[model samples]
Target: MSLDAAPGIIAVTLVTVATVAIGTWGLRFSRTTSDFFVASRTVHPRLNASAIGGEYLSAASFLGIAGLVLTFGAEMLWYPIGWTAGYLVLLVLVAAPLRRSGAYTLPDFAEARLGSRAIRLLCSLLVVAIGWLYLMPQFQGAGITLHAVAGAPTWTGPLIVGAVVLVNVMSGGMRSITFVQAFQYWLKLTALLLPAAVLLIVWAGEGRPRPDVDAAWSLPLADGGGIGLYTTYSLILATFLGTMGLPHVVVRFYTNPDGRAARQTTLTVLALLGVFYLIPPVYGALGRVHTAELASADALVLELPRLMLPGPLGDVLTGLVVAGAFAAFLSTSSGLTIALAGVLSQDLVAKLPQHRLSGVAAFRLASVVAVAIPCIAAVAVPHVSIARAVGLAFAVAASTFCPLLLLGIWWRRLTDVGAAAGLMIGFVGSGGAVVWTLSGGSEPPLLDALLAQPAAWSVPLAFAAMVLGSLCTPRRVPAHTSRLLVRLHTPESVPLDRG
Candidate 1:
């Protein structure tokens, strides 16, 4: 199972260089605060969609999905299924209205919709919290990838990725990284797509053996009759509903020119994600047949190429996957860093004395801090299943922001008090579950499952809180709610004051 490291090292180096080169080149187009924040909101559908795909296809998509499928079998497919369908949820319920809100960040949206600085501050806190939770796994995955690629130490990967992302995000902000990330999306696609094609040909030549699937692994839902169904549905709920709430993902909609462009971008992202997701399952199936005994399932994609091909050809393919893996870490990490930096810098600009720093300078400072915390955490904390770690973050987002976004946009009755109540309840409930699981506490089976996968209970609870709180304080609803709803739902052709 051992292989040469030169090819992987080269592949990773090239990807890193290309990412930095593309991002640096994009600096030419970035001049103002708008450019740094949202690419001046002029990105068209195709490009914005590509950037979103690049950012959205984290290590979870590139490596973790295949690993999960290899280890857990059919039931894990719900992750990608739910993740992709989440955008459809986003398209129907959120995209246009969110863009119409004309907010720079989710917190901005909350503040505007509720007309409360208090709610905005609360949203900002959750954004940073979720961003850190999501970003940590990326650093962890980088450590795993580099370790798989060249037997590098685990700590080295996070530091390298953190340094690279800090440079990229600090250089030109979202405008710069959008170009870099869009290019990475295609690289990631090619990384898995071509390798799968070659592997299938070899697989066909070798008589097309079926994957070794036991009865339990073959089930669509997992094991444990009632419990498995609950876990599967809980996972589906988290991934599907969580996509809209991810700060890195949600902020990209702000990069589009208008609501129509946002919708178009989402459609494009759906198509791109659909294509990319098809490849991981192929790797998983092949893993079952070829490299079933590998020590770490996370390295299944990396090792499978060499195990089957066994020559210069194998090394080349492994290198390509390595490139894709690094791209996954950089693109997603860059996006998360940009998102967190945006929220942090805005806080600085609003709260700090204006003469101390300008927006861009404030952003640079924030980017360093945003990247540093999780980078340190990745090194200090023991690595967990990369996919599971990401899912927990999604569960947190689903429970919290899912309610806020849905209720804020559709239910004009959503008052600040209600929004605040919902967010706190959601955050504490899901975040507590995450901490409990992470801290390695487990006893009763039902209780373990409930805390491990909190979305099922937490999401409904948050939604209920928001609804009840809003109903109880009816007069607290903003006076401008009706006009804002009209603007949010109205066609751009009508030419109302979008301001």
Candidate 2:
């Protein structure tokens, strides 16, 4: 191998071996189906928090945010800010209530809250859709990272990640993945932090030269006038509201010991994410000063050390980043696979009478479905910026699940019929916009912009649909909603006949 290829190859090999090793170690603890699905609800708060941070910090955080920061300047910081703050929203609003509900997946929560199998089915499909959408970008980022580091074919990256994640998931399920993902959070943090520190030192030694970009690059909402402003706020809404709805994220809460543990995990995740996010923007700012001529802004972090230092040190930094990038792909892909697989096993695979799949068998089969579709789609679909694709996933999630979760937990008047209607309306509205945008049909500038970032409008429309529909059918509200609300809001320590 050439100088460029050897370090990348070594780093990737080590990361892969380490990941499989950690996963195998976790296998000993994963005996029952509950263990496979939620580690039997026994994971400690700190470890669970680390795993949540690992899985939640996807390709978008590792690669896409810096690219956006480089391209659009301060406005793009909203990506990371909204992402971290979303956990705050989860901490205060969703986490404890969700854990108290005792649902393994979003679909489980939907069914438990609304008492409707049809709604459960709809939530399952949405979970699958959002997981696939989110997974596609991780795979794409993998392709980009591998190509940058090792000069490999694009398809190889996604294929390698998909296969590794599938094996980790199938062998030991969530129990195994929990350990692997926790390790990855520290790995990713180390990967980004070391290079950023060295690069900042290098930048200072070179006399603190500023980027030669124009004034507009430093200003928020300076480009494209009204559309820029609209896009920024819409992105904010999507990410802030959307994080709670993500299937992979919600699945992690199920592993907590109880509602209080879930709350603690969310709080710790906010801290982990806050520290990790600070490093990416450093790459973006430094890239402008030193390496503006690179082909892709997304590659700026990987290329910066090499561009600035240009020898053994740069090469080593590249290797570390390559490992971190791959870790990002692996961790996020594993989490999504686990979440989607759970839904598939419970709602799809086991529902087939003739399949006769046992607990592990159904989950393994569902793992295949969860991993394969997105891997294929990643290759088939034209590559958008990884961050943009992730943002779209957030948009769909905010439109569909955010309203369902908020109203379901907080409102007694939220009827099953209303929830189903809201979900369908959100799905159709946001899903249609996603299809329209991805199909390469942007027109009538205003309409195109609205479709491109539909969250600001779609979210409210879904809420409105739910509220109005609930009012129209007030008699259909679940009789036990009040009691369930008490269970959700009350302290777990409080003695009551919850049953």
**What is every candidate's alpha-carbon RMSD to the true fold?**
1.5, 1.0
Give every collision pair in model 1.
none
Query: In candidate 2, which residue pairs get closer than 3 Å at backbone N, Cα or C atoms, i.e. clash?
Result: none
Q: Stretches of candidate 1 above 4 Å error?
A: 1-3, 353-355, 497-499
Task: List model 2 lDDT by residue over 120-158, tens digit each.
Answer: 999999999999989998998888888888788899989
lDDT against the true structure, each candidate: 0.91, 0.91
lDDT of 1 at 63: 93
Q: Model 2 scores what on Cα lDDT?
A: 0.91
TM-score of each: 0.98, 0.98
Off-target runs (Cα >4 Å) in candidate 2 are none
Per-residue alpha-carbon lDDT of model 1 for 190-309, expressed as tens digits? 999988899999999999999888887767796778987898889899999999999999999998888888899999999999988888999999998985576578888888899999
